[model samples]
Target chain A: MGPVELGDQQMVAIQTRNLSRTFDEVVAVDDLDLEVHTGEVYGFLGPNGAGKSTTINMLLGFVPPSDGSGTVLGHDIATESLALRRRTGVLPEDFGVYDRLTARKHVEFAIETKAADDDPEVLLERVGLADAIDRKAGGFSKGMAQRLALAMALAGDPDLLLLDEPSTGLDPNGAREMRSIIRQEVDRGATVFFSSHILGQVEAICDRVGVLREGRLVAEDTIEGLRSEFDSAARLIVTIDEPTDDIVTAVRSTAGVVDVRIEEADIVVSLERDDRKAPVINAIEDAGGTITDITSADPSLEDLFAALTTDGDGTDLGVSSRNRSPGRPRATEGDA
Target chain B: MTWLHVAKKDFHDAGRSRLLWVLTALLVLLVAGVAAIPYVLAAATNDPTPTFESGLTFLFSPIGFLIPIIGLAVGYRSIVGERESGSIRFLLGLPNSREDVLLGKVVGRTGVVTVPIVIGFAVGGVVIAALYQGFDGLDYLGLLLFTVVMGLVYVAIAVGISASVSTRGKALGLVITVYAVVDWFWTFIPMSLYWILERSFPGFEDLPAWYLLLERLSPGQALSAISLTLIDTFGAGDVDLTAAGRVAGDVPFYLETWFAWVIVLGWIVVPLAVGYLRFRSALLN
Candidate 1:
């Protein structure tokens, strides 16, 4: 209706409201609303075939949305996609490199495409591919190719980065290195939006995480916030030199102790509150049970992910934060 | 700017391919062998002067077929191969629009297909000057430029098919069909069908005029007609007009030798425009 402005003052780096895409009869992404802030490393977590790549494709304007609208850096995803792409660096999922080009040439081509003057050698060195600069990518291993892709994505210091399944072909050590590079990118004032199925990888670096299931955003929060939102009950396992009935009774009588089990050498107590652990240890010692080891297992983000994504009749025991609305049938969040 | 980068990269990549080198060698050898034919004939007949008409005869036939094959070799795999390999993601991840990608492929592949043809023509020009005593440099240049234009038309057609089709195999099939229909069967099959049908009906005395137009509509036929019109190297005896060519003399302006150039221009532009429209909205997988 009006002349579109180039500079969007919206604080969000990526914001999509009711964005949707469908193929024939199958809905790949459905009525999805997502908000990712500037300078934040946002982790989009979803299982395989949960429409992660479809959403990214729509956001980047590679696949047009069947319905709704969205924007990246204040530019419409459908209209100003070229402007959006100009400022964003992307490592697309299931993408390949030019096998004829060497690793350094790939980075140089990216730099040329972006019209930037960054040194290709420095970029390759950052991605740990300096030794393979002159070698053609046709002979590269999967990890080497992935690293070259990453180097290309990071060439021009773009304002936003979209990396879909960035760790798909990396070893554990390589994954760690990739995570550190992501952290550095975030520190450079660029918002990083990456998709991953591994909860541990997301937990290590994501400032905020969104859980996607069957094309819907079930939960969106920080890692600690999500852990509390799903289920905060911590497992306090105390290993003793010998098991005693008095110690078991003392632990069971402690306040906020939901469940207590005595295995051969340990007293496992499930506590509703973390502060209740002090009284359980005191009670075990007061009953002449000598403690040898104590391990407190808090409810992890993995547990939260499983609780949010798993679909059933919604009757999982001891998961209290499953209290969200049931308006969307696909997203069974807070019903644990 | 991004399109140029893409074109440069594509040109460099296609140049380094072993298949292109092999094709170049074959084209050069074929051109050299074809160029020496007039010289051999002149020696056998004891004629010191080989006319330019003899020089243009065999050169046009083999090159008429060879240009389409070289164009197919370069352009058939430009876009569909990238789409299949998923490198299109890398290309689009940059600042380029879909038009840039398609146009870059057209230009880059045109360079790949045209370079060897130019080299072959240059080598053939050297041999022609040495063999044909009455060889006109201007006429030779016109023939060389016309051949290059025909080569570009086929390249556009091949690249157009590459962009319009969804799979590499489909692109391959479509380009091969284009070559077969336009070069090999455009004149023969339609004329044969017309004669067979006329014999049954007993109403049509001669082949229909539109059939002649259809034959001339092909890029190969248009190039042949346009080259003869542009440079009159062929003597009356050397020029054996087909049925269409004989009828072409009395037809309207649209069916004249000058109109073949228009067909050549259409051959270059129409397929590319259609392919560009189809490619603009194609969902990259």
Candidate 2:
């Protein structure tokens, strides 16, 4: 295949075609195609055992591909791995840091190894690790350790950043800081590719997302595109001053109204299109029912992810379901 | 340049490990204790004449076994531990070649092992010089160099095993078995053959060259040769040259400096080459 160019106008920074990895009898990544653009935070969304880490490993040259190829930043992933590695920084999901070295030393070693000119102290401060920089990493808490790992990855000021669950062990405030840092890096014209099962975080940071299920890229699109595609139905929750049979009848009579359910005093009407809102409001007023409150709920990215990733049997989303309990809001296009 | 950075980092990191310091101290104590045996024996006997041969034999006797143990300790975890701890990926991610990584590790770890051995020998040599009254700096240097070379051989073998194996236990087991078979059991093969020659055939006084070559293959035999030379210098009892020693003697071997140099060079080069090859193909991830 000819070299795939990352265009100057286009944001595309990573492109893969038919990339596959097989270990003996099992295929880890199969016929996968992906594109992550420059200054874009692409979230690799997958459940546990969904080949997310395996794909990342291949991208980083930790493992070789069984078939096909790709390029990162115009460098061939297979043949020019060293050059790619030099320009790319990765924070692996599995935590592995030098136990004997302090956090500062680990970052310094990473920077030195990469021949980077940045000061490690500044990187440590940015990662919120300035206080713990002098302490050995063995005593670090899980979140602290992950922060240090992220610091190490960012040490070289790499052009491409690959973070696997970058906010895995962070608190709400820490997760917010991580999102801001990712945004700052992207603002500097770097591409950020990260994987996470946290739908909220992905929605907060990722410009686009790719969903993998059962070793395949089941879905890939911008978060906005996914929201538009999967949340084809919108719901309007309306609270009226008084319940009336005519209001229900009028809402049902409106064009583009799919379903309406009354819970307590609110009429939850599912719309076939976003334009149905004006017609539904006219219909309700025509029936002489005064509207007290009206709210439109768009489908989240998490909802789209759930609908797209579930097996036909209606079981197993294949990502980490632990810590993420049932009834948590699924990601939609409009989430922060 | 990247390799140098990695090597420097590895040296500093391993140096900071308390386990490394403890291991170095233990090795020094063991070597010093072993070297003091002859002195203690001579002092007990009230014989101020500490023969060079006895000193050589005493010092060289434990080397074959001790050197391999040192090798096992230093090398069995070099690659495997890094792999387990996830640091191997970081190392491999660098632009440096795998050979550099393996060689740097071997050099760094060898340094860790060799420093104590040298200090121990220096300390032992001083005690022997002060107490025994007859001191040959050249002989002591030769023996020290030989021991270090022997240490390198084990380091290489251990590193090769470490690169090939996934677990420390398996690498340790393989190293110990190889060391035992090569150092101890291989000698029995030549001895048993000689016994057969002496008893089964009368007037078979001429021994084959291959039998002598077989004995030299055992690092213990090579170390014993150096020990015998040291013993002779100290006026100690004679170290009998077995079939291998006789072949070494008949050849233009420099017992003092040249022979020691050859043995030491062989120990360092051969194992390192094998280790480098194995490590190059290792799937450290």
Candidate 3:
């Protein structure tokens, strides 16, 4: 199917319009606009120090915006922040839990404070923390602590969940488990807004993704759309019976084939589009070659993300750009 | 309701800490040692000079120093520790109002610290009664009540400092410095000023009005006044009507000293209110 079209009927769980936070002369979040619909997992993609956390902090009302305003769960982000806090849960990038309190007590205290009726043991079990429920959090491993943090965020059965780099310390299986829990939460109609440096996880779980660079959002679209937009180059891998110079020359001479590289018994050809597959096959046949096998490769999310967040000159979005006008948001529509 | 939950959690958590138990034990020992000193002194000295009032005076002097120390220790890390631990974000992110959290913490910590002070005073009062065989019940009650109030005022001041400072170390240092200045130096300054004013100015027989103001500035001085009142009420033995005439007149006049109570209550309320306001405005992310 094509990119899932978000409809207006989907309530906006979070919406920030021209939100900005500045510390003295440094702008941490500059004219950032974001929207996350109900039951959607919006992945905020950025590297360290990319202002993703700052934007999340603004949404959580931990920091007030220096410029514009936003709303969380239909509550004003500024004036009615307490009401917003009631319906929202946050797992910060850094894990900080009480060292002396048991996991059960910690979750219990959080639930009690929020006036939530959920059983702490049940919540802990949901996060795979039931075994360590009675143990103090000081001895918890990083993954375990992350899970506990997630459990704390879920204490009140909040409608909106904000996770910052939730998969940072997880092993492969733990990461998979986290994805499943995220999916479960989404299935239960909870909107998840998470930030991550990894592209594969975002591609796997995020329904919509926004890329932030140097305090501004440089790109925002569905994962498929982002990949398709920057997908100008494709790969054609063909396993041939024999390595011959004529076959290589024929394949390289095709109209759309840009580069060729040989690995063992296979010839890898770079093409502009999948339609170029036919001409390359025809050219190989004309060179008296038989195609053993063929596979088409497209750009991954990592590649598209890298291209969109970096300038033509290869300067990363986190760096100052000479081409970028002062106070102007970076244009992302026609980049690829 | 959230405040009640927060208070219960804080109280339970604080109760579990070994440091709190150690501090309480130390306070009890200190009070015990001070209370026994009078009896020990009276027994050892054959001069027959140290009476019950002398013992009362001796005990009152050191209890004054201990009160402010307990106040500072109990309150210096109240909010700053939470900020450092990062659990504060979890609490502040809840629907509960910051004011409720602040006030609840104040109540919780005060309860934890004041328990030992009350027990110490009660033990001291019992010791005074048993050792001297002439102790005043009303005097002991008043002294115990005054010590608790002194503790409340100092705790409020320390909490205010804690809320204003970002680090526990800074809060501890500031509370200690302020306590030392107000409890020790402020008392001496007013008395010295009173002596100088009396010697230098003619018709200055009436203590300078500033003297009373400055004296009241010290929590120790307030404790001293309360202790003296307690001793007067309990230790006096004569009951002659004419002799009690001046005493009766002064008793009624002293009872109308509403300004003293106002100052003491202000000491508790003003700093606490300021701390709550500052804490509510704090950025805990």
Candidate 4:
């Protein structure tokens, strides 16, 4: 069900074994193993300072691991970094721009470095930067800088695109545009590996997600798989025709229903098992509230991410870690 | 084996600096403005032949001071500045290797310094030809070649320090220390060591061969040695540069004037080689 099960040489885009890095004495990345298949967008999810950037740096040969080995596009990350980088496009974290150079010059530098015959204008236009192509990067906003970096990463039509925190300084709309550009790159058969601290940023684009906490990977699965693993507390929203206090009571009284609330036209019910959905719907209908629309909130990745990333706290299987404020999105700053 | 793109981009980035224009203007003044002084003095004395040798002799001291400063200013931050600003991501993120970046920076900053020198020579060379009677193009070209080579050596040294250090402060401090020791006080180092080891001050005659070699070791000294030969070719007999004049009866081959070219090549290659080795092994954190 995962990329590792493919067991083919050409199927792997990135692979690492026992990868570890330590800064002085603090282990930044610990004994990690990962396999990302060709042509899949693997989202590396972690909280801030959870060694996500360190892992990415090691993969790109920017940081040599204290131990272990890895390969990108079958080229050893340590020994053959130049050859690996030739086929790989990297949008590095905390990257700065040459203030004196224009947006077009930035992209042209990439193309020239990679020896790729690409029109910088085309790449800039692809990133919605046509109007600012000639502008110097010193005047660019953070989001504008992020877009320019993406255009540079898209140079040479790389086989693998390693983007670390690709949505750092984007507003909601710009984030969506970035997602579409990532989609276009993936559609062209390039593998994408992007890191994000916020699950909301990557939920709509990632093919598979790996949750990293405290320098160790905690969970790895498809989005659906991660949801199902934590689906015992999935929120169920039943859109009813009429606002009814009785419907909440009825659903709460139903077997396997844990919590119930009525908000406007919807009866929100929490279920213990996936099978309890039918009983809750029947209870709502029997309470004289007509069920027009029903949607199981599918644990929504936020809950799963919370459950996976919560530290030594009340991490009971059926309990919702959403109560822990640590899992909430802190990077809501829309780029000014 | 420098990447042309990196070099080109470096030149373009540095070319935009107002300091570069100021340095260019300064060089033009030093070359043309300063070289015309000989013509003024010769005209006042009603001397019939104001030789090119006088202009080269006049230029030797000022060029030594100006060339190293221009080279250091252009190259001291070539690598460390990118690292400090976090823009090295764009450089190493591409296909270029760390070695290529260092070499390209040397090549690039060499271009940055050479352009101004070329412009200054073009303007000043014309003025000197019009002012002086014995204007030999070959001797003038020889001096120009030495100026460019000296520029290249200083750039290599600055870039080497840029690559070796992790912080901008360290790079600046190291470059300053190198410039002061190599350019300003190199003669004093050998002199001090001679005074210490020989139990007496070294006189102008019969100095140890090691002392002469050590004295000519710094980039500035080697450059001067080569320029002395170039100036001698002017045949004006303005400055006596032959080693036998100061040394004992016979000079060792290593102290020969032409051996200074080997020292110049060493200054260019050694700093770059040392810088590349350090830069290649470093983790760009």
- What lDDT score is found at residue B227 in candidate 1? 77
Rank by lDDT, descending? 4, 1, 3, 2
Evaluate candidate 3 and give its CAPRI docking class based on DockQ.
Answer: acceptable
B50-161 per-residue lDDT for model 3 (tens digits): 4555666566656677778877788888878878877677767666667777777778777777778777766766666667646666666776776777777787788778
The TM-score that candidate 1 achieves is 0.82
Off by over 4 Å in 3: A1-7, A232-298, A310-336, B45-58, B118-142, B188-205, B222-256
Runs of candidate 4 exceeding 4 Å displacement: A1-10, A233-299, A313-336, B44-49, B229-239
Deviation from native of the Cα of residue A331 in model 2, angstroms: 11
Q: Is candidate 1 or candidate 2 better by DockQ?
A: 1
Best by lDDT: 4
Tens-digit lDDT track of model 4 for A48-152: 777889999998888999999988888888998898898889899999999999998899999989889999999999998999999999899999999999999
Candidate order by TM-score, highest to lowest?
A: 4, 1, 2, 3
Q: Considering chain A alone, what is the TM-score of candidate 4?
A: 0.77
Q: Can you write out model 1's per-residue Cα lDDT over A182-271, one digit (the tens) per residue?
A: 999988989999998778788989989998877888888998787674354566778999988888888888888878877679777878
Which model scores highest in DockQ?
1
Q: Estimate how well candidate 3 is docked, as a DockQ score.
A: 0.43
lDDT head-to-head 1 vs 3, winner: 1
DockQ per model, Cα: 0.59, 0.39, 0.43, 0.58
Root-mean-square deviation per candidate: 7.6, 7.3, 9.1, 7.1
Model 2 Cα lDDT, one tens digit per residue, A1-336:
322444466745788889988878788789999988877889998776677888887787777788888888778877877778788887877756777888888888788878888788899999999888799887888799888878878877888998988887899999999999999998987889998766778887788999886668888888888777645567777888886888998999899997776767777787778778989988888899889988766544565576455534222221212224433665433221
